[model samples]
Target: MIQGAGTVILWSATIERQADRPLAEVWDNLDAVWRRFNDHEWLSGKAHGHAHRVDGYARHTALTVNEQGWHPHFHTLLVVSRNMPREQAVRLAADIAARWVDAAEHVGVVASTEGQRIGLPAVALPTDSPHQARRQAHREAVARVQYASHQAWGHPGSIAGTPEGVFRAAAAGDADALDLWHEIEEATHSHRLRSVGGIFRTPAAPRR
Candidate 1:
């Protein structure tokens, strides 16, 4: 329920629909699951890249069509602002998968017994870790994001330009960089690529 500060856990999971559902509805289903996790996470007053909520969380998500044209799925990089044990994280992740199934049903979307699946694996990083270490975290984050976005709808230029490009842009204040992001969103018609809560955000806009 609680963890040490200065440490953060990064989780990677896929939120998937059991059947082919409308694109819009798929997003709704994922959003429902996202909210449930946010509401229940044990508060850990740790800072992300920037000062953030005591129990802050951040994520980078991309949508893709499941094997069949039946529905879309999400590859998400979930970041928790706390140092939690692997066992705890595993338990919580499994619970969240069940919650997603229930949440989608409640939302009047795909609620089948096999309706939604969120597979979670986790790794922890100290907030004050070295640049290389943080970049490694970002690498995992970027990989998931690109897999979803590129798989669903190919990007002429790699979404992040390079594997770590996404992390670099997270802090860029450049208008063009922002616009490129907008294009990415437009490609998928998604509201967000990276989601952040509390004082925590993916990256700060580079200084003007």
Candidate 2:
């Protein structure tokens, strides 16, 4: 967390799992939507009709394939400019989720706004200062992102559950999983898995 940072949130987006599109095509569309959402001016800062609140962000994207085709999405850690109440943070999450949905639709990707989740800062103790509260929130945000990344591959000790299951099956010579793995490699080659944006691009930005 940086100075004045507040309201950490976790946001996610993924395409329709059952879409019949080829893996490469589906990945391309999802990638396009992500780029669109990232570059949207409305999300850069304060907008014409709404306050975007966000000042910096870090994103981590993952791609996994299973029986449902390709599943690719990013988990973002958003740092707002100031501390906000939980209700306000929830509203902000919804607003950002709606924009993400719009970006996906514009790129011909079917996405669910329901998956655009948010996690607020931890409750501060009566004696904690504003900076302490923000630091606590950042810690929670990092933990949530880590949890989300692992949960995507299913719970521990479940070898048959995906998206980890796909790889396990492929190793065991499962024909479908093998094919999906091939496509996954082709689609993800040379693509970036992490990104930093806005004030995070500055040298002064904190990295933790």
For model 1, give the RMSD to the true fold: 11.2
Clashing pairs in 1: 20-70, 20-71, 44-54, 52-199, 53-199, 171-206, 172-206, 173-206
| Candidate 1 local lDDT, 1-208, one digit each (tens) | 2235223333443444545445455666667755654454423323223232234455666443323432334444445545656576666555546656566556555543343333333233345566556545545554554455454445545434422353357457756445444544454565565665543544577998
Candidate 2 residue runs with Cα over 4 Å from true position: 1-5, 46-50, 121-163, 202-208
TM-score against native, each model? 0.46, 0.71
Q: Which stretches of candidate 1 lie over 4 Å from their true place?
A: 1-22, 36-54, 80-82, 111-124, 127-190, 202-208
Strongest candidate by lDDT: 2
Task: Assess the local accuracy of residue 89 in candidate 1 as a C-alpha lDDT between 0 and 100.
Answer: 62
Q: Rate the local accuracy (lDDT) of all candidates.
A: 0.47, 0.65
How many clashes (backbone N, Cα, C below 3 Å) per candidate? 8, 0
Ten contiguous residues minimizing lDDT sum, candidate 2:
120-129
